[model samples]
Target: MGAMVYWVILSLSILALGVWVFWSVRGVRAYVRARGKRLVTCPETHCAAAVELDAKGASWKAFRGGNYFRLQDCSRWPERQDCAQDCLQEIETLGQGCLVRTIVAGWYSGKTCVYCRKPLDKVEEWTGHMPALLDPDQKTVMWGEVPPEKLPGVFENYKPVCWSCHIAETFRRVHPELVTDRPPRW
Candidate 1:
């Protein structure tokens, strides 16, 4: 009788542990899905608008991945929803890096291009972001590689780059030998 009682206690303990673990995992999953929104701007000539995207949704992944680079049905340019790249592109899940940068953009300057120092005519000019290089000698800035823990300290480091300069800077950083003369603004 004592042996049976011991066995039953052990079984109950195991069941309780399993239940605790299951609830913990489900709670964490729910918490993770509860938050996140990506602010996207639609650049369509006919329908320019800004919409906040749900980060948990697939659409947000494509939108925030490259701000419409791969996914087209994002707030930035929803009209491109039918593009092959939209669904095929990998989703960039938002975290501290994305949040801090957007916050910095609001606190700092959003009206002009940091590279070219030109007024960003929203209707005509498209804009992008390139993370600020912490080490001048590093040769290039890879936003994805920027550690999230360091973002809080370098809110001012995020630079607003117009599409034209973003293209040039990205190319120059990636292939330094290809670009000999710098843009006049650079």
Candidate 2:
């Protein structure tokens, strides 16, 4: 009789754990849906729009995956503020790394360092490594090992810079004049 009781208790505990996990996952999905910003398409007009979600708002819905969230009435959301369409179009046209490449190119292309106004050099000189920096998630080297045909958008224009320049520029963006006093050293 005691063995049966223990088995029943174990089964109930497992059931309770499963229910708790389900509820927790549901809550996370709801949160992601509310916080995530996504480009959504309108089915009626076949128009695309950027939808900003207020995670705390009443109309937010849980995305299929607990990793993200979406708006329940995306169309009803104001059109003027709906940048999702433009965002989506750009994403489709340029792919994920487009913006990053553009930014890096702009910085390298004679845009003086925020601190010293010195021209940034190509990455090969500073690091002695072919690729300067890599995309953390994609594991692709942004500077080296990129083929011309595979270059997305402006990434082909990417140039490598010495570590000193990169570090100084990063610091200047956050705290202007912080790294200016330091001499540029490779």
Candidate 3:
């Protein structure tokens, strides 16, 4: 009876271990399949490589010789946008001077604050402060302090502006139809 009980316990433990191993392997395989680059043949010269689509679906990168090359959806070489275009254009223009080629080519590297026209690098300078409009309406304003979480995007696109400028710019961008007249205060 003792021998039978010991054998049963050992068998159950082995079965549980086997199940755990199977589940773990399956999860890893699924993740790899979802994230792995798909193999493709270059249409230009029939060269084989691995390619992955970016979030925009318009851009793609092909991995070849341990390096990644940016290629558009049409499989052509990437080109810079117009010089007058905002943060993205400035970044592209400065690309010649930047030593980090990989980051320069990546997305969001060149976007700047809309108001100050400063590069995204200075985002930390103007976060967690009250906007000028809030100062006047402090008593009525429900939120006593600006939440830290909302600072990143706001600072990224509209830093260095006094509170009034920030509000004006934000309103202009988010509600162009409603704000026909520019705020005379700024």
Candidate 4:
């Protein structure tokens, strides 16, 4: 009888542990997916703002069955932060669409590098090779170098460059004396 009681208790414990683990994993996924630079229109100012969500806070709240989203950082901070976070509604509605990663990836899709004319693939952090953009004046720059609030305009005005060409162009621009012009061998 005692052995049967022990077995039942062990089964219950294992079941409880499994339930806990399931919730924890779901919460963590919610947190990770929500983490990223997001673009939203500020309700009060009616201007675009770059914002980061409070991922940790949302993760903790996820355990309670709903995510509690709040702004972790914003481009229009220190001056207009006190305003109600009506912008979160946009995130709640759009989900991953507002992420800068998603937006940039969409922009690069089906496009070739302006420099090498090679197809620009998805941005891969593991490969340590991120693509760049060529500004209107022909200067090469990374996306992070531009302010998030100005990304919309920049995206419209700039041209995409592959990782290899970006490095080559930057090197040539920085050391023009060392980089001699080569005639087309073709």
Best candidate, TM-score: 4
lDDT of each: 0.45, 0.45, 0.37, 0.87
Runs off by more than 4 Å, candidate 3: 6-10, 26-30, 33-39, 43-186
Clashes of each: 4, 12, 1, 0
TM-score ranking, best first: 4, 1, 2, 3
Which residue pairs of candidate 1 clash? 41-76, 42-76, 70-86, 71-86
The segments of candidate 4 whose C-alpha lies over 4 angstroms from its true place after superposition are 121-127
Estimate the overall C-alpha local distance difference test score of candidate 1.
0.45
**C-alpha TM-score for every candidate:** 0.33, 0.29, 0.24, 0.89
Candidate 1 structure quality by residue, lDDT tens digits, 68-148: 223223433455555343212112443332343454344444456567776544432213444333234433354456544
Q: For candidate 4, write residues 18-135 as lDDT tens digits.
A: 9999889978987997799998888887888999999988888886588687998999987877878899999899889999878888888888899789888665641587788999
Tens digits of per-residue lDDT for model 3, 63-115: 11122223222222233222222222232344333212122223224554334
Cα-based RMSD of the predictions, in order? 16.8, 12.0, 15.0, 2.1
Tell me the TM-score of model 4.
0.89
Q: lDDT per residue, candidate 2, 7-46, as tens digits?
A: 9999999999998777667766555434433344444455
How do the candidates rank by lDDT, highest first? 4, 1, 2, 3
Give model 3's TM-score versus the native structure. Answer: 0.24
Candidate 3, 131: how far from true, in Å? Answer: 25
Error of 1 at 27 (Å): 14
Candidate 2: list runs displaced more than 4 Å: 23-51, 54-186
RMSD in angstroms between candidate 4 and the native structure over all alpha carbons: 2.1
Give the Å error, residue 146, model 1: 2.1
